[model samples]
Target chain A: MPQIAQLAQTYASQIFWLLIFFGAVYFIVGRGMVPKVLATVEARENQIAADLAAAEAARAAADADEAAWRARENANRAAAQAIIAKAKAEAAAAREARLAAAQAKIDARLAEAEAAIAAARDSALAEIEDVAVEAAQDIVRRLAGAKVTKTAARAAVKEALAHV
Target chain B: MHQFTIEPVVPFQFAGYDLSFTNSAAWMLVTAVVLTIFVAGGLRRELVPGRWQMAVETFTGFIDNMLEANIGKEGRKYVPYVFSLFMFILLANLLGLLPLGVVGIHPFTFTSHFTVTGVLAAISFGIVLVVGFWKHGFHFFSLFVPHGTPAVMVPLIFLIELFSFMIRPFSLALRLFVAMMAGHVLLKVLSGFVINGANAGLGIGALVGLPSFALMIAISALEILVAGIQAYVFALLTSLYINDAEHLH
Candidate 1:
């Protein structure tokens, strides 16, 4: 074979060039470029990790803000409820006082009206008795043609009124 | 065999040596230049890599992972040499199979030469030897004798281990050289049949030439697969051998 025949002649050149070119590849590619590529990958990974951490921090801050807002909302609602309750209580007390005062005034007026009615009935009975006495005396004098005293006529009228 | 002949492109001599710039040396230069361009193109170092960068990264990462698996942390230091070796061989193998013959440029597979492969194997073996001695000193010789050996069987086992260890470089070189040379020879033989059959008669051409042509196509595909497999095998064995040197087991 030519490969075997030419071995003695060509071996030196082949080896020499192989070493030179292979050495070039080793230095240029392996030492020169590989480290840079790996570094880029590592840097990218670190950036991703940092971004994720930042996102987590922002999310936590948002959650804390929401919690604070909820607490404030709850406090304001409680304060409003207390004010409503106080206003309702004050209104109830004021209404109660007004109702009691009006009731006391109505009771006094009702009592005065009752007393006036009683006095008017008493005066009317006394006036009716006097009239009846005078009428009885007149009737006696006209029928018998005798004069009758006021006191005796009043007493007789009283006795007859009583029997009647 | 004429395809395999080495013709000097620029003749030179130094210290009584025929160190001429031959076709083999030219192809070696081509492989180096092409590889450099491929790698340099991918050196954009973008956070998001393009297809070219991805291709380059994939190959480098492949070698890195293989070494990491085989030799652990210390394997990282040998990445450049192994990566250079792998890409060089792989490109040389594939460049040989390029159907550029129609354009009158018959690519030479320099790996088909045993001398070229022998040197590559020697380099790997040399590294193994250097690392073994440098790290473990003379204790590296203890690799020939396995642990828990029967006293009577020690000599025999040592002989066997020593023989196997010694043949590693030869085997490495022979495997790649034979594989590449055989594929090319087969393809050449089949093409010969196709040409001869067609010259002889239409009947023989239809019978032998047609099937051979079809087989040539199939074998060409197999050759491509063999090219990749051979390169991977070389790198893997080298790393495994280095592992032995590093750990001495």
Candidate 2:
């Protein structure tokens, strides 16, 4: 009871100090500490957002690069296929030209061999005609005592070759 | 008995008022000093907070969340006032419970006096009044007259509402002051028993003294909890009152 009654006497000092202390605490915590804590929180939030954004950008860039590389690879393969097709065409053309040249040389050699055989056969036929003419003249002298001409013998042999 | 006594550390008078600095004032200074060191020392810009910084952050966040939950985002402007309110009262309560004379001085709680809580409550009530008028002008008076009341019941309801409104400061002050004062007094009484029992000699003394001492310790722990909760309740109500004034519903 006495304490309650004495509250009047004590109030002035208590309030005075309370105001002073409370004011001091308010400034220190309000001006000094609260902002720091808020700043830390804000900074963390901002950093997270930035990191996520960077990661997204990097991923996008990587995807683009991969797509470009794939495109280039496809293009190179197509180019290689075109070059192979062209090379095959050139090789076939070269092979065709060489084959044609070989066939022409074989045809020329066969014509020369046929001409030489024809000349030898003609010479043998001429010599056989002369011999036949002489033999015919000698046989007539012995059997019938009649002479045969070389022209007639040759003509006969030619007609016979034609018929055979 | 001397625990409740107010002795002036430096006796002075000004304008017929006892402006003398006393143990209560000294403890306030002590509380202020400790709070300054605790808060200001933790203001470093650490990416990962140290212990002191973490403690400071936790307290700020707790009050911030409480205000936001109770009063909405508009209550953020009152952070300094509410934060200081919680810290000062909480420290005063805890400091009062510290062992006396260990620091070669006796300390008293400012909150144990009705005057301290009275001032805080008055401030809270005053803010509500000023903000209510400032925001709504004459419309603030409508706070007492709820909508849809019949004409005959208006006066009666108005009187009741006005009475309740006026009781806010007194209720807030009494709740904190009485809790702190009574708990301290009860601890003092129990310790008195223990001392007396010890003085009376061995057999009956042990039987009375030990349990009394144990009970005192238990009560002190409970008082610590009460101390924290009371501070929280004070700030919470303050914010709620501010919200009511702001919204008028």
Candidate 3:
């Protein structure tokens, strides 16, 4: 066939061009273009990874801040509680001291009043003894139709008062 | 028949070698220029690539995956070579299908020529052979020797394996060339029938012409598919061969 016959005439140029063109394509595409594309993809991946990491770090920082605030709040509450407890103790102590002072004053008044009562009782007893002595003397004179001495009547009344 | 003709534009001869710039050579140059522009233009560093850039990326990825799958990650180095072969063949096939065959200015049926396919095949085979030897040295001969073959069957198996290895290039080249040539020829023949039928006065001629024209359209679609398939097959085999060379056994 002419096709088979034409092979010899055309083979050289075809082969030459094929090598040249194919080699050119290989170098331009393989060495040049491919690396750039791969780099873009890699760059994107790295950027995404970095962004996610930053977000996580920010979240962690927020958590730490929150925890610190809560701790501070708890510390302040505890301090307030301590102050209230201390004030209560101090108030109780003051109340007790005042109560003790009032009791001391009342005790002193009670002692003075008891002393006054004892003196009054002694005076009253002496008055009653004199009255009794007079009565006894009058009665004795009427019965026996004789007069008794003041000293005797006084001594007799005293003895009767002592026995009663 | 005229499509198969290779008319030399600039003729030269040195030591009995026909080193002429033929129509085929012109198309090759055209293909080279077009491919360079495509590769250069598609080089965008943006994260979101444009259509051209995406196409370029997809093309590279396709070859990359093919190499990795067939030949392992080390096969990555052969991406450019295999990618070039695929694009070159694919473009040549598609260009041949264009209506430019009438003017003959663009001799686009370059891939349909056996020499063109043969050269590509030979190059792939050469790489396989050279790399096999270079990587393995004298031990590359062991590629033909089947492991676990009995002593009695060793000679037969080795001869068969050696022959199979040698014919790989021819098979690759013939498969592509024949498919392309046959498709083009059939399309040509069908179109001729349509033209002849429509020219022969009205009624029955138009009826006969319409079906042939319809059949040509269907064949054209099929040819486009074939062009893609042949290109893929050529590149896929090249990668596979490279795999065999690189990994051995």
Candidate 4:
């Protein structure tokens, strides 16, 4: 194996330059590079913030749309409920009017029926009185074998009333 | 022909591995200790940061930026490891350049060996591999497989993907080793020439060696830049490997 001394003797000059190379990169990077990266990160963060703000605005808009839809839905429900109540009130009024008219018609029919019954009753009473007078004259003629005078008729009417 | 020579200093074998408590190791130890102290004590944290804190933070921030830019934010996770690696390499390379004529003592640049850098590269690759498996599970292995094609094309695509996936370790190891070794040898040979010329004659050596010295200086500057660049690239690629894991195939 080649000795470390021999190798070092031959290569001393080369070692020197390698050292120079390391120095330049070190100085430049420490001073220049890191700051640039930090700036970029800061810029990125700012952009993210802006994007989030815009997204929040969009979310708020969506919420507003939902609220509007709910409000319209509620209005429709209220309108429908009012219409149903109006319809129900109208139906009730119509039903009450129909019942009142039917009752009036029935009362008029009853009154007409009552008047007809009263006329019939008067005619029947006159017929019954004539029949009764004829019956009484026949019965008296058979019993007495002669016509009854007005005073004797009154005496028999009183005797019949006293026996009843 | 004159013989080339350098005197050996401290040498011993402590562990199973060949150990040389040479100048290189000394400098490496110094670098490690200094860094530990600097981080622990210098950055000993307060409510607000101080100058030392700022310096450490600056280094960390500098490396972090480079990784993010080159490999992207996915690269940031490797920052701690990369930072430590950079510190060690930077200190080693710079120390290697320092005037080490303090008495008879010399300084060593830890980056001289292909094995040293190769191991670092290999370790980095290993980390990438582990992460690939850790993050992606068996699917990372399937990075070798092609997707969204007919069953007829699957075999050919799989072969291609396999080759690409296999090349990562080789590429990583080569890039650092070659750059470091090549640059060092060039500097040394050129410096050797100047020393020879100066010994020959003062006037002629000044005339002849001036350009060599200038070349050495220019090359030195370039090497400094290259050293830092190589470390960054190593860390950057490591992060990319991590990213590959994250993304999978």
Leading candidate by TM-score: 1
Give the per-residue lDDT digits (tens) of candidate 2, residues B96-181: 88887567777688788888899989989998999999999999878989999899999999999989999999999999989999
- Model 1 lDDT, residue A120, Cα: 84
Candidates 3 and 4 compared: the better one by lDDT is 3
Q: Candidate 3 — which residues are off by over 4 angstroms?
A: A39-164, B101-107
| Regions of model 2 farther than 4 Å from truth | A31-44, A73-164, B101-104, B146-154
**TM-score against truth, every candidate:** 0.82, 0.78, 0.75, 0.55
User: Candidate 1 clashing pairs?
Assistant: none
What candidate 1 gets wrong by more than 4 Å, as runs, is: A52-164, B150-152
* Local distance difference test values of all predictions, in order: 0.89, 0.85, 0.84, 0.65
Q: List the candidate numbers ranked by lDDT, top first.
A: 1, 2, 3, 4
Instruction: Return the top candidate by lDDT.
Output: 1
Ranking by DockQ: 1, 3, 2, 4
DockQ of candidate 2 is 0.41
Q: Model 3: per-residue lDDT, tens digit, B44-107?
A: 7676678887787777778888998999879878877888889888888887788775785545
Q: Which ten residues in a row have the lowest lDDT in candidate 2 chain A?
A: A153-162
True A-B contacts kept by model 3: 0.61
TM-score of 1: 0.82
Location of the lowest summed lDDT over 10 successive residues in candidate 1 chain A: A33-42
The DockQ figures for the candidates are 0.53, 0.41, 0.41, 0.01
TM-score of chain A of each: 0.72, 0.72, 0.66, 0.66
Q: Which pairs of residues clash in candidate 3, taking residues 3 or more apart in a chain or in different chains?
A: none
Task: List where candidate 4 sits over 4 angstroms from the true fold.
Answer: A1-164, B1-17, B46-48, B66-77, B146-153
Location of the lowest summed lDDT over 10 successive residues in candidate 3 chain B: B99-108
